[model samples]
Target: MNLKSNYLLFLVFLMSLGCATNPFTGKQTMAIVSNDQLFPASFKQYDEFLKENKVVEGTEDAARITRVGQRIAKAAERYLNANGYEGYLKGYQWEYHLIEDKTKNAWCMPGGKIVFYTGILPVAQTDAGIAAIMGHEVAHALANHGQQRMSAAYIQQGIAIAGNVAITDDESRDLFNQYYGVGSTVGAMLPFSRSHEAEADRIGIILMAIAGYDPAVAPELWKRMESSNTPEFLSTHPSNSSRIAQLSALVANARAEAKKFGVTGFTE
Candidate 1:
């Protein structure tokens, strides 16, 4: 990288620091990737995953997932449009799926490709329980966490690339890449996943409230999630107690957020 190119990259980095305020907390959030750059690949990958995965047929559960996802996606769109990100979702291909798996987990990939595992149905004890999980996962996708994780990995791999250039052989380059991959996954990805979990808990409350589910029930859903505390590696979520306390503190604020979305008559 020449001096001018290096300066240009730095300028790119600075320019990428676009700000979008969080509607729930009325706070600014750090966002690096633009929706213009981020949406296309996410849409492609989401379509590919749907084609490959065993997407559940439109059963009652599947319908529920789709319904909840659409509601949340719309609420998110309203938030973005209201806050001047009017075209942020112009290319977003929102999707939802329910898979017949027994693992107590659910996730929404980038570009709104969501999955609900049958195994998690027990933990998601009710419609509200499902809403809790949906809110959290939708928040992750909306916040561009998947792209941020990839960007963080790119930085780690870039350092390994630097190390490889100093070495003599392709074998050494492969070794460094392997090490970088492992180190990034264990060190950066886990912590990043944990942060997503925490942020989801916080953001999820307001989302659920805005969608008119009782945000107070958020803690109760977390209590159910607590029943299975696998190792941190096995489970990417925060501990139950942590989520419970966090959501409890945000109930008032979640209600306040609900009003912004015109959600009234929510349970206290």
Candidate 2:
């Protein structure tokens, strides 16, 4: 086989070998970097981040962040165990911290390390609101979005390499690179990321409901975020309006799902 053919075959093999099923969605997703590799790196980075930032503790808001985070984590475990994916979170060293930052952001790293920015606490006005945010962040980790993103990036790079190798003409290769970069990002990567965000939103609501937090608060929380949202096509996350609409529609379904787990009450 020619070098180009060899590269293509290797790409296919790489893709075929590095896949894992998402228990929540039951879809095979890319996992070029396994959790075994991703988690330690994530933990290290999280620790570095905490060291660089002021972590709020000994305060009610900080306590609430940890409280909500633990509840969300337990809710995820319950859902996974009930679905027969017991021990799915083994090796996950869950930690939650409230960072004193002005950025309205909160994120959960691969190994369940989470940080909530103090700036967002006002937006996440209540425990249920915090649960909404916590659930969404935890859902991203539970769904293995980080691993999938890294794997997808590898595929994108691999395809670019194959294209550059196949096209012998310098001019053609340059043009191909330009178009491929924009086309692949806009057409494939953005949509993939948006889908992950939507899936996290769906799963987040269910988790918050099961954790005894009102899933209905999810939409309200998004409403508060609407002012800062970018256009849907250009952003990694769906538009806040879109998230609000989706969460609003899913509230009843989330409550129903929680009821199956004997969770009949929700805190507002």
Off by over 4 Å in 2: none
Query: Where is model 1 more than 4 Å wrong at Cα?
Result: 1-38, 163-189, 226-236
* Candidate 1, 1-268: lDDT as tens digits: 7554564566556545666555444565545565567777777776787788677895998898888778778878887777777876666778888888788888887667788888898887767678888989888877777766666555555555556555568898788788877776777777777887888788887788887788888898777764545666645666677778888999899889889877887633
Best by TM-score: 2
Residue pairs with clashing backbones, model 2? none
Clashing residue pairs found in predicted model 1: none
Candidate 2, residues 58-118: lDDT per residue as tens digits? 9988889888888899999999999999999999999999998899999999989999999
List all candidate RMSDs to the true structure: 4.7, 1.0
lDDT, residue 239, candidate 1:
67
Q: Give the 10-residue window scoring lowest on summed lDDT in candidate 2.
A: 223-232
